[model samples]
Target chain A: MNDDEPLIRWQWIADHTAELADYTGIHLRLGLLPVLFGLIISVPLGILCHRWRWLYPPVLTVSNIMYSVPSLALFMIFVRYTGLTEQTVMIPLTLYTLSVLVPNVVDGLASVPEPVRLAATAMGFGAVRRVIQVELPIAVPVVIAGVRVAAVSSISLVAVGQLIGQGGLGYYITRGLQLDFPTPILTAIVLIMLLALATDALLVLAQRLLTPWSRNKVTSA
Target chain B: MIRFDAVSKNYPNGTTAVDELSLELAEGGITVLVGPSGCGKTTTLRMINRMVEPTAGTVSLRGRDIREVNAPELRRGIGYVIQHAGLFPHRTVLDNIATVPMLLGWNKKKARTRAAELLELVGLPAEMAKRYPNQLSGGQQQRVGVARALCADPPVLLMDEPFSAVDPIVRAELQAEFIRLQKELHKTIVFVTHDIDEAIKLGDNIAVFRTGGKLAQFDTPERLLAHPADDFVADFVGQDRGIRRLSFVNAAELPLRDGPVLPATAPVAQARAADEPWVLVVDEGRRPLGWASVAELADGGTLADASLTPLGHTFSLVGDSARAALDSALLSPARLAVGVDAEGAVVGVADACELSAGTTAVQAAAGEQASTEAESASSESRATVGKTSADTPGGGDR
Candidate 1:
């Protein structure tokens, strides 16, 4: 097979439509699970850091280390520890993202205007109630922005799960390189790129839906 | 009844906002805390509801210690209005006002109903309830702030520079609305402002605070204006205090001789008062129709035929401060302002000479002129207290 043959890849993709569906289902599950986990862990952690300033430097340092850890090295480190299993891959990807996500969540919330918070307190909102009612609502736009970035990042990272036993699009690329058949590999690359674009578009729609007030402000400005 | 007993606040940086200040806010009247900035006027007001906790002493509400109660719970029970209205931008006007009630777990329906009722009570229509804070004019937003504070019907209301955000015109309207509301609700209020005139206008008792959180003087507006505690209080209240006093006198309060009911056939000898140069002419019902000089009376002119510009009934109602009365007198064309009863009948006329002297002193002081004008006006008015100095054209209260 020709190394750069587009028609061969198109044929392979058409033949493997069912596999593509399964891949989509898997990619979606992998992408969303980590985000849901990150949101839960990071929102509370961010709030903790917000209430106590001393916690910020340490939390920021941990997040920065996670962010700077090369994805491929993280993959190898987890694989070496857990022996190339799917769970090993998923866990590291989720843990690695906490760095980017925790900071975003914290920064998203830290930016809520001082006057708005003051007004909330003056209105008799206790600490937790202020978090839920005022801070969360005001931080929605920035929080959603963080989620968008994290979701797209997770989708691209989870594709690397093919390095182990998981048969994701990353598996197809590895398969083609092993067998010297360019069709499966190029098919995987195109499909993954399309998935990334589609997921990003979906997140943008979600952001718009959740923050109409922000939308009005942006357009009016 | 709000009482501050030796209340003092020291910030974490060790700045003393209010230093051991004690004062009693009356049960159903407006007590104004007037001072320069950093005098702790605002800090004193905030301590009443525990927004700023007192570092040294207790602030009591109706004799109950604020410290003994839960701070948030106590705050929910006290209405707080701050400068710029401090409205929550994310919430609608109705939601903003309903904050305390919702915190107390009132059913949504009841809270919304209360918010709507309060919006109407503050002279805003119920339609304004759905708009957000950014959508409102400054004055409307401040009214909503007041409405929100009053939503829970807290017996003691604390307002800190509540009207400072609005222009003068709306401020006046809001002041009038506040006075009207106080008359009806009888809620005890502690108002803080740097504007001395606002304190004079709204306060039953005005407390003048000097810097370092020391209260210079506390007294009724009449006494405070008539006799300031020291040079500081006097300067702070402004130098034109005598003009501040004429507001106490009404046009009808001064002795007015009855006008002649001289019809076309009336006799000249019995028609006009001989002691007066100009006799007021009126119809039989004692309604002043016009003025006829003694020269016209010599021509046998009837009261109906006199040159009467409507006596421009200027009157000071009970409870209006000297400032408000001076303002009213200044606005009237008639130097002799008429004080009317609530029924609008002429109660009495203010002495034109006194009102002018009072107004001149205010103008002189307000203009930052030296005491020269005030001294001259005082002595000039003292010389003519018994005589109507009407010929000193255009100098009364205005």
Candidate 2:
């Protein structure tokens, strides 16, 4: 708390390069694994909701309710079952992803043009084949847009997991606050922001590679 | 070949899409089902491929019940084209065309090769194979739709307003290409459209449906125009159908006369001596130059020296229809349709009155033959069945 203390100390960073690298790796895993699991669960759930019209509203409401539970309280609730581990932090983060991922998944599938869907059916595509080949491919751009939002938020939310002992780079953020050292907090915030931006850029690149045909705006005839 | 035996499609909400319809579509010909919106022409067409299942009765394909086959398997055997092209936006033009072939279990290499060939067949350049559907024009997208449908070369093809989405000029061009393709392919096609003109132009047999899913008439386009089955059909065919029927009669059949035709070298006094109000001046090779008013002949000069009114247009005796002759006659400054030979030399001329008489004679003869056929096949439905024969030449020159 000294007024003359520098906001950032260069020596602390140079000395903690190995520790920073380890935390960065841990941060990415904690942030990304949930998104990966969310996608796996959401896609099938979304397809089921799309196939049955009534399922979506209830599913969306429940996921939104789950999302509204404060992340810290969600972490604490999971703590009793899984104990003070990465599982406690990750369990809540995974559930948080459902609110964003499910709607995007539903909206992505809905984005397919009706005519294209009919054409696929007429061309002899079976239900599963059409969903996999035609509908899902067309839904990619919209789904990836959802993924970008989910990914960035997921990465940043990992910092809040610092309340539990399993917070990745969040440990430094809390450490800086407790000791009244500003350097680790600044470095962690900058690193977290950089991770979010880099993940978003990668998702954009993935969307570009996945859907080359969508590059041009479609003109309805 | 496809047959619908008392097929009735009635929805739970009391909408009768198709009612007690019994139709036999001829193989290797285009059978157009045309009517106004809500007339169930589309519903009837879709029932063939089971896109819409019939609530009652049976739809048999080539003597086998279609319900015996799985829906997806049945669809794979029938080609379908729709308005807006409905091409997959995620796939390239070649890949879109290759879809059915790939679904049929053809190797990727073989499927793509067939797709490339179809791209050429549909009159698209090979380079367009790699481009997406959105990158192309509306007309181009339609061509790709047709190419995609034909890739599997199924014996039966169903089209639901395929060309209705394009501009008029492009629609006309696509129509011409479609007729040309039909001649070579001869796949049994069921085309659904609200356009009566398109039905008359492309159909080997036109099935005109009334508002309540009733088949008003199913007959050759010429017969449909000349002898509409009822008031609904007569009105549906349009009041100008008498003029439209002229499209069926060949222009060569019109009786032409050499009246008032004079060589340009004839003296002005000789031109003045012509009985007609205008003298049609001709060049040395007998090609029509222009119409010269007999009263406007100058003093002491040849007919060539007289100021002549331009000839509006001429109908070709070899290829044009009676409609073209009538159009020419109506538009000409001289009120005479000049008929020309293959070399563009003036053969003869006919006024609109003469052209109508000529077309009437052809229609009377055709009507008599149609009536005789109808009488022999006493049942109205029997008379309409499988008459998709040589009459398709109606669109040959168009």
Candidate 3:
């Protein structure tokens, strides 16, 4: 708290490179694993909802209600079960992704043109095969769009998990506040923002690579 | 061959799409089922492939009941083209066409090679193979649809208003291409359409269905136009049926004369001396140059120097029908239908009156032949069997 103290101590950064790398790695895992688990769970549930139609309203309602639960409160509920581990943070983050991922999965499948579906059946494709080979592939662009939103939000939300001391790079923010230092807080915020942007950019690139046909309309005869 | 024996389609909603229908579609020709919407023409076509199962009776393909076969397996063995083309937007044109072959377990290389051949067969360029369906025009997308359907070379093709989605010019082109393809392949085809003219133009035998799913008439296009079975059929066949019937008669049957046709090199005096109001001027190779009004010929110079009017159009004696001849005559400035040889040289000319007389003469001869054929056909079976047999002679000639 000296009047002569600089906003950022550059020597402190050079000295903590290894610790910074460790926290960055933890930050990515804490942020991304929930999104991965959420996707795995949502796709099948979404497909079932799409097939039955009536299943979607209830499933979406449940996911929306789960998302509305305060993330801090969810962490507290999971803390009793998992006891101050990464699981306590990840469990809540995973629940938050469902609100985005499930509807996206359902909408992605629904985006397949009706004529294309009929053509597939007429050409002797069985139901399962058609859904897997044709419907899923056509749904990629829309599904990826949802993934980008889920990923960025999940990455930013990971910092909130510092309340339980499992926050990844968020450890620096709490530590900086305790000592009244600005350097660690600013560095962590910048890194988290960078990670979210990089993940979103990668997802966009993946979508482009996967769905080159839908990138632009070609009106050539 | 497809047979719908006493077939009926009654929905749970109490609508009867097809009622007590008994139809025997001949092998190796186009049999069009035509009627207004909800008449069950599409339902009848779907039943042939078991896309719509009959509620009451059997639909047999080549004498085997279709219901006995697995629906997907049966569909794989039949080619189907629907309106809107229904192309897979995600797949490339070649991969879309390669679908059935690949489903039938064709190797990737073999499937793609066959797809390439069919792309050419459908008159699409080779470079289009790698492009997706959304990149194609409506007409081109339809060509890809046909190629995809024909990929496995299935013996039967069921088309449900396949060309109706395109513009009229494109539809005519597609129809002509369809006829040419049918000529080469000779597959048993069950085509469905709401257009009576389309049925007449492409069908060997047409089955007309009323709005209530009743079979109003099933006969050759020629016979259907000339002898509509009931007032419903007569009304459906339309009031201009006599003119439509002329499409069946060949242009060669009409007598033509070289009366007023003169070389463009001939003197204006020679054209003026002709008894006709207009003289048809021809080039040295005898190709029709233009029509020249004899009264408008100048005082001097050759017929070429005279003010010439364009010959509206010429009908081909070797290829065109009497309907085309009548159309040409009506459009011509000289009021004569100029007949042309295959080499494009002028053959002769015929006016509207002469074309009408020729049409009546051809009709009388056809009527006599049809009666004898009907008698022999009736002796072989009952009245229903006679109707089918009577269509064969006319079908073979076409």
Each model's lDDT comes to 0.71, 0.89, 0.88
Instruction: Provide the lDDT at A72 for model 3.
Output: 92
Q: Is candidate 1 or candidate 3 better by DockQ?
A: 3
What is candidate 3's lDDT per residue for A1-221, written digit by digit as tens? 65777889888899998999999999999999999999999989988999999999999999999999999999999999999999999989999999999999999999998878877877888888888889989988888999999999999999999999899999999999898898898889999999999999999999888887885577775
- Find the candidate with the highest DockQ and give its number: 3
Tens-digit lDDT string for candidate 3 (B226-306): 877777888998999999999999998889988698998898888777888999999999999899988877888998778
State how far residue B184 of model 1 sits from its true place (Å): 1.9
**B240-330 in candidate 2: lDDT tens per residue?**
9988999888998889998788899999888777778888899999899999988767799898788889999989999899999999999
Stretches > 4 Å off in candidate 1: A1-4, A7-9, A80-83, A165-167, A176-221, B245-398
Query: Candidates 1 and 3: which is better by lDDT?
Result: 3
lDDT at residue A82 of model 2 (Cα atoms): 98
Model 2 clash tally, residue pairs? 0
Q: What RMSD does each model have against the real structure?
A: 10.1, 4.0, 3.2
What lDDT tens digits, residue by residue, belong to model 1 across residues A58-131?
98898778778876777787777887766666676677668767777778778777756765676677889999
Q: Tell me candidate 1's fraction of native contacts, as a decimal between 0 and 1.
A: 0.25
- Candidate order by decreasing DockQ: 3, 2, 1
Q: Chain A TM-score for each candidate, in the given order? A: 0.88, 0.97, 0.97
Clashing pairs in 3: none
Candidate 3: segments with Cα more than 4 A from true spot: A1-5, B374-398
